[model samples]
Every structure is written in structure tokens, then in C-alpha cells.
Target: MAQFTFEGDFEILADPQIKLVESALQKKGFTNGKIVVEPVGQKGDNYIAHVKRFIYEAEDGTTFNMIGKVAPVAEQLRLMMNTMVLFNNEIVMYNLVLPKLNDIQNSAGVTDDEKVRFPACYGVVTEEPYEFILIEDLKEAGFEMLDKMKPLTNESVRLIVKDLAKYHSLSYVLKNSEPEIYESYSNKLSNLWAIVGAEPEAQQFFESGENDLFKMMHDVSDQYKNVVRGSLTQITPIAKKIQSYEKGSKYSVIQQGDCWNNNILFRLEEGKPVDDVMIDYQLSSEGNPAADLLYLIFNCTDHATRLEHYQEWIDYYNETLDHSLNLHGLKANHIFPKDQLDADLKRYGKQMVNLGVLLSSMLERESKDALDMRVMTGDKEKLWENTMAQMNASLLDISTIVKIRQRIMGIIDTALEFGLI
Candidate 1:
């Protein structure tokens, strides 16, 4: 009913082509349609356009709404490899994993309610080098992005932990029940972190912030050198441990490889948070669940609030695991005893040290006036001034150096508890 202007460099289909597509739909039983393109949103190199509800004057005048995604040729080409990787992952999930699981369910004759934990896939269009997918637009479906730095309510935390447990449990079952499939998926998850770590850009980024972060972790290094020595001695082993986990018979389901808040979508039903849908599976592959949990906590929660609620969140994760395992006819004790889980929590928790340093550098706030603060292309002196100004503002609270120190000390304490250092 409402029309809006759409602007982008994406190739717009001609009126004739639009008519052909519409006619094709009409022949397939759709009717009374008018196409209006509405600008949706843009991220990185892609743009989303919406084809709103079509009103049909015939056959009860039902309205049908669909979405279309388009992007510039250059942008599409730039991200082609990344896009292909995600598409391949989706195909594997749909073709190899979902069907097998469904078959198993049918053979067992289990009538219990089982929901597929993924976005509804309508179809994909792949013509030549351009590829686009029509998917259920979660933004239009009443889902709000979770804000970083805001501590989640106990209820919301519970739901997240519960969903994670179920996800991990499913992966565990598939790993043992179908080893070949599990191995196939597992092989896809190579050490991507190693590649990133080896990059010169990464080295420069780390070097830029190392001195400030080192001062923050100074206390921990001083107080618990004996304990954290191992963690400090080898970044490679730490990187590997942070990437993979070893649980009895269960192989890791793809770690939501990137566990930042923005990558997760929370769905609320009846005024209560009920579900979490993880997106951007490009980096996903076999990994430790603890790494995901720790990464999310460090990146999403403010450092000032984390220590206060850390234990409670851990307990919530355990409770979710217990419930999910019971539903799947598995027991938590059989997979990870209470003692072992605690130990892993402590040991693997040191991985948060690397993550904390990374988050501090990346999440520092910059004002619009600080235009020269852009990390990629700004002049070095101007960017340094802007970064220092931002750090100074943070320092007025307790000094930027002190905050970094505190985070490092926190990591040391965790490492000591886990006997990792």
C-alpha cells in the first residue's frame, strides 16, 4: 500500500523482466500483484531490498510479501569467496545433516515436537557469478538486536545458555551416531585463527596496542607467573585450545566461530525471550564451546560488570546443559562431570585473556568529531591523537592503563584457578 524509494548500485531488473517474474508467479497461482522496491539495510558489501506485500483483487485478495537482496558487482566480487563458503556450509547442513537427522526421526517414529534451529530457507538464485538467497527476514519478524555492554537479564541469559546446550548436544549425538558425517564437517574447520594470527595486519594491530595491554596484565604476570607461564609461553597451544575442545565421545559442532552479540538473534514470544538464532556461520566449525561462551561474555559484557555476574552465567550454562541433555535422552554427568566442567571452565577460561585484550582495543568508543580516528586509512599522528583522546576519556574513570591492568589481572586469576599457567 505504501511506496518508497530504493537507492543502490545493485543491478535493477527492467520493468519487462519484473513483469515476466510477476507473470511467472501469477501462473503459479499468485495474483493481483504490484511490485514496489523498498530499501531495507546495508552491511559491509551487500544491500537488502524488500519487495513488499502484493495485493490481489482476485481470489479473496490475499497479500503476499517477499524480500530481495542485491549488491554492487564490485562488492559482490570482493566478498565472493566468503559468500561461497557460507553457501557451501548451508548446503552441507541442508543436504547431509538435516535429511539424515529427519530420516532417523522418522525411523524411530518419534512424534515429539522438534524444531529446526535455523532460518527458513525459501530458495536461492545463482545466475552466473551473482548469487542471492531469499530467506526469512528476521528483522521484519519482531526480533531486536541485542545491545552489547548491557548485561542480559537472568531470564534472557537462561534462554541463551539453554539453546547453546541443545545445539552442542545435537552435535555430540551426530558425532557419535554418525562419525563419518561428523568427520566430514569437522575437517572443514581448519585453524583459521592461525591464518589470521599470521597476517601482518594482525601483527601491526596487536603491536599498536601491546604496550598498553601489557601494563594491564602486568600484575597477573607478576603475581602468578608460575601458574600462567604455560599460557604465556606458547601462543600456538593457547590458540589451538581456544579453538577446539575435547569432550568424551562428542565431536565439536561448529563453534558459532564468531560469538559476538551482533551475530546472535534473540526471539521473544509472549513478552519473554524464548529462542536464540545464531547467524554468520562462515567461520563456524569444530571448536570448544567454552571458547564461544567466554568470547561472548568478554565481547558483549562490560568488563566492570563481568566479574560480578560471571559465576551466575556459568551456572546458567550448566543448567541449560542439564535440561537439554535430559530432553535428548542423555545425561550431563556422562559427558562432563561437575568437577571436569569446573576444571575446563577454569583452564579454558584463560583464553579470555587474549580475547579481553582484543576487545579492549576494538570496542573503545570514538566520537563523530574524531573522524581521523579511522583505523584503516587515517593519518598515523591524527589517528593516534584521536585514540589517545578516547583513551583519556576512559581514563577519567580509572585511567585507561588501570582498566587494561584490571582485565589482565582478571585473566591471571582465572588462569591460576584453572592451573593453566
Candidate 2:
């Protein structure tokens, strides 16, 4: 992890970056300003970007707060992630896809309160190899991330899935009404799963797959190690299948792709999450709606919650999506009928099992070491060695191990039930 303090690293701000900010603020009616940029989140957490909180004070004493997300300054990191097509997709998302979705919702007579909200993008620099987007700071707008350290309750899960339904439904409507536009948008996006799955390092890691993390599952089942191994091996095949965009698929939409607790921010009222917004669209791509739902379920909820109310949660998502589709003068049957949605779940559910094993371990692990490991992109053996090291460190925590086991077992059970294993 690199140390980035406001005082020592203030010189890192280039004149061009400041100029970009000034141009963006001028659009919002701010004239002649003094701009100060400070580091915002953990530098280790964001391996691909330099996230800065920008404070612009106008000559008239008016102030504007915006987030400037810029590409990594490190040449090696930037080149590696760029080859994987990471940063530019987000630039496309905030600039193109989100505004289009908002317009589609507005035309459908959806109220602002009910609409799926994205932060307002003030400006974007789409120059290749130096992409960044400036959007309204959600924290200043009263939105906060659910504590990543705490387990999510049923209510938080409900809000997350419900919001995801609305987000997916708009794309459904667009796919049905204007296939060309939807096709173009989906084509422009990248499937992040494919990038990771296609990595020789990842595949080799899956092969050499006896995990210390899985050792903690001794009380759970004898098959735990094999289940983890087999699921990881399947990531590449499933990702290739999804990214193929084969003909005769009944439905697909541009998913947020990354759906962990960190990427989602919520608005709280009386200590409960009332409304939520999603951020970090670098992984956005065309996929089954089930991809997003099952990912959220396995990563965010406990085993008991899913076992008890899985069907209910699925129904709720469909109902919300259906209602939104109806408001847009479209029938759910024409866009995403119930039967197709069911098939999608069965087909794509295995991918969630794969993701849960990898991501749950990641969530529980030490953050700084994990970021340090990310730089070893090309070395398959070294990356796997470091990954196992991180997992071993996390296994020392009994509570984290319990949660990891619960999630892994739940996913494995669901995958078996859905005939995905």
C-alpha cells in the first residue's frame, strides 16, 4: 500500500488534471475558482485509479464538491489494467449508458423518487489511456456505503435486490423496444469475468487448489475442498459462454458487474437503508439478470437467509421489474417473461458459486496485502501463491471463517439444486 497524504502528494496534481476540473465546474455556473484536490479512499483498495475529492470555491464564495476518478499514475499498473479494458468502460458508463437509462425511465413516466438513480456526471475526459469521470459526490448528497465489516440484514438485502430489479428492467425495456441501441450499448461494454477467467494465472490457480480456507470447513462436509476447486475451474467456461452473446437467448441486460458491498452506496433514514445507488461500472456488460441477483445473494446474505427466503427474494425482484416495465408501456412477457428468468437462474447460477468462493475470501482478507498482490498480473504462480497467503491470513479469524463457510456451503447447495454443478 502506498502512503498518500494531502500535504506530501499535493504536488502530484498536474496542471491538466486541475484544468479538467475547472472546465467541469464552469459548466455548472461556477466562475473563477480555487481548486484543492485531496486523496479520497484507500489507495490500496483502488488499484486502478486515483480517487480524489475536489473542493471548488468560487469567487462569490459558492462551493462545489465533486469526485474526480482518474486512472492510475503508475505506468505498469495502468498498462496492465488497460489491456484488460478496465478504466474506459467506466468512462463509457457514466457518460453514455447511465444517461440513456435515465432518459428511458423519464419517458416511461417514472417519478424521480421511484427511478433508479445514478450520480450526476459533471464532465468526463475520454482521451484514451488517460480517462477519468467527474460526478457529483454521493457522500455530500447524503449517501453512505453499508459497513463492509458488518453482516447485512434482510432489509438491506431487500433494498439492494429491489433497486437492482429496477436497474435491470430499464435495459429490458430498451432491449425490447429499441434493440439496436441496446445492442450498441451492450457491445461497447466489457465482461470482467471473462478477463479474469481467461487469465492463465487464474486457471492454473484453480488447478493447484487445495485451500487453507477450505480446511476450516472440516465440520461442514468432506466435499468442501473439491467443491471449491471444481467451481473455480468452471469460471472460465461459464464466462466464455456468457460473453459469447449466442443467438436465441431470450433476455440480457447491462449489469453493474461488480456487486459487492463496497460498490453499492445507500441512503439511510432512522438508521435503516431507505434508498440506494450503485457505483463502479468498470465491469458492466451484457448478461442474464440472474447474474446480478445470485451474486448479491451469495456475497451479501448469510446461508440461512438464502435457504429460508431465496424464492421470495427472486419473486420480489421479478415483481419490481414487472411493475417498472408496465409503467414503460411494456409487458414483462415481451421483455423478460417469468419462464425465461427461471431458466437464466439455472443456467447462470453456477457462476455465482464460482464468484462466492473467490469474493467471500477476498472480503474477509486483509486489504493492503491483497492490493499488493494485484500488481503480479502476469505471473500465474506468484499471484496464486500470494492469494493463498492472503486466504491463510483470513482463516485465522474464526468469525470470518464461519461467514465464509456459510456462504460457500449455501452456494454449493444452491448450485447442486439448480443442476448447475
lDDT of candidate model 1 versus the reference: 0.50
Q: lDDT (CA) for every model shown?
A: 0.50, 0.72
Tens-digit lDDT string for candidate 2 (174-236): 788788888888778877667665656556665544355456666666666677756667777
Residue-level lDDT for 135 in candidate 2: 86
Give the lDDT of residue 34 in candidate 2: 67
Off by over 4 Å in 2: 1-16, 43-47, 82-84, 205-220, 245-248, 366-403, 413-421
List CA RMSD, all candidates: 7.3, 4.4
Tens-place lDDT per residue, model 1, 125-233, is 4442334444455665666556543446556655556556656666666666777877777665544444434534334444445544544455554564433333332
Q: How many times do residue backbones clash in model 1?
A: 4
Looking at candidate 2, what is the lDDT of residue 126? 67
- Determine which window of 10 residues in candidate 1 has minimal summed lDDT: 42-51
Using TM-score, give the best candidate's number: 2
